[model samples]
Target: MDFVLVHGTTQSPAGWDRVAKLLRAAGHRAIAVDLLTPADLPVEGYAQHARDQYDGERPVVVAHSGTGVLLPAIAEALDARAMTWVAAYIPDFSGGRSLRDEVVELFAPEWIGVDPTADPAKASEFLFHDCDPETEHLALDSLRLFSPAVLAAHRAGPAPEIPSTVIVPTRDRTLKPEWMRQAARDRLGVTALEIDAGHCPHMSRPAEIAGILTGHA
Candidate 1:
């Protein structure tokens, strides 16, 4: 099966390196997209840019963190067979709220204005605490800074009708575990799959993540 790994904010394609490698070793194609959109671009532009990365494989699209807001559109465009959201934001398609609104309401005060790319120390402690030194270093080094303006610019559309699963990182320090569980149940109407890791599970627990992906389908 083909898998498209969509990264979150302040992240590069390298963030999915470990998981992608594991998938490939198991004879599956994995494309880790680099969706570092420019600050001037809106969420629509970000969606289009991400769509253009693949050739309509209808793969199982996996979204991480901030990329959740872009998932519905990207999934519809790709005609995805299945979707997996990893400690991600679930957009409100009712035209009720924006990504910024969700962040302000759901995120912890300390995580509000924090940029992982700008502060590697903070990122290491919060986002990659479970990772080894080398993995953490690689993640920190590959961070890409971008404006949060795009979050406010996002206008979510109806989510596609497909098989979707939400994976919550039980030990995550950045995004609250309670919110992850609540959002998964209330927004997606499904029980989340829990994993023992920090924010970047693909980096810290690649084998476990890969096992879930393969077994899920």
Candidate 2:
């Protein structure tokens, strides 16, 4: 199976390195799309960019953090076999609401309207508290800044119902875990798989993530 991993807004594709390596070791093709470059694109444009990055057969598209806004469109464009959201936003864009609007209230007070990429310490504290020193350092150093335009992007139409799973990070310091569960149930209409980790679980718990991916596939 092919897995296309999309990183969060403040992250680089390298964030998916550990997970990708494990996926490959398990005989699966895993590709992490670079959604940061040309960061001015809208939600739909980012979906197109994600599609162009991988040419594999119908893939299992995975979204991490803010990148979940791109999942539905990317899934449609790529004819994805399944979708996975990792402590990620699940934008409904219903009533023409922007991704930020849908998820803003769920963010921690310190995280709202602040650029996580600007402060490595805060990024590590909020997103990588569960990570080892090596992985935490890599994630902090590779943090990327995104334009406000992308945060304001919204879908114009409803998305098709696809097989999907949400992994909620119970110890996440940025987005509230309680809301994550509620959102998954209310918006995605599914119960989330709770994992004991911070926001960036791929870096902190790659083995477990890889197991879930392979097991579900």
lDDT of each: 0.81, 0.83
Q: Candidate 1 on 25-75: residue-level lDDT in tens?
A: 999999987777445666667667778898757799998888788787777
Model 2, position 28, has a per-residue lDDT of 93
lDDT tens digits by residue: candidate 2, 11-63: 88888999999999989999999876634776778788888899988899999
RMSD vs true structure, all candidates = 1.7, 1.7
The true-versus-predicted C-alpha distance at residue 155 of model 2, in Å, is 4.3
Q: Each candidate's TM vs. the true structure?
A: 0.92, 0.93
The collision pairs in model 2 are none
> Which numbered prediction scores highest in TM-score against the true structure?
2
Q: What is candidate 1's local distance difference test score?
A: 0.81
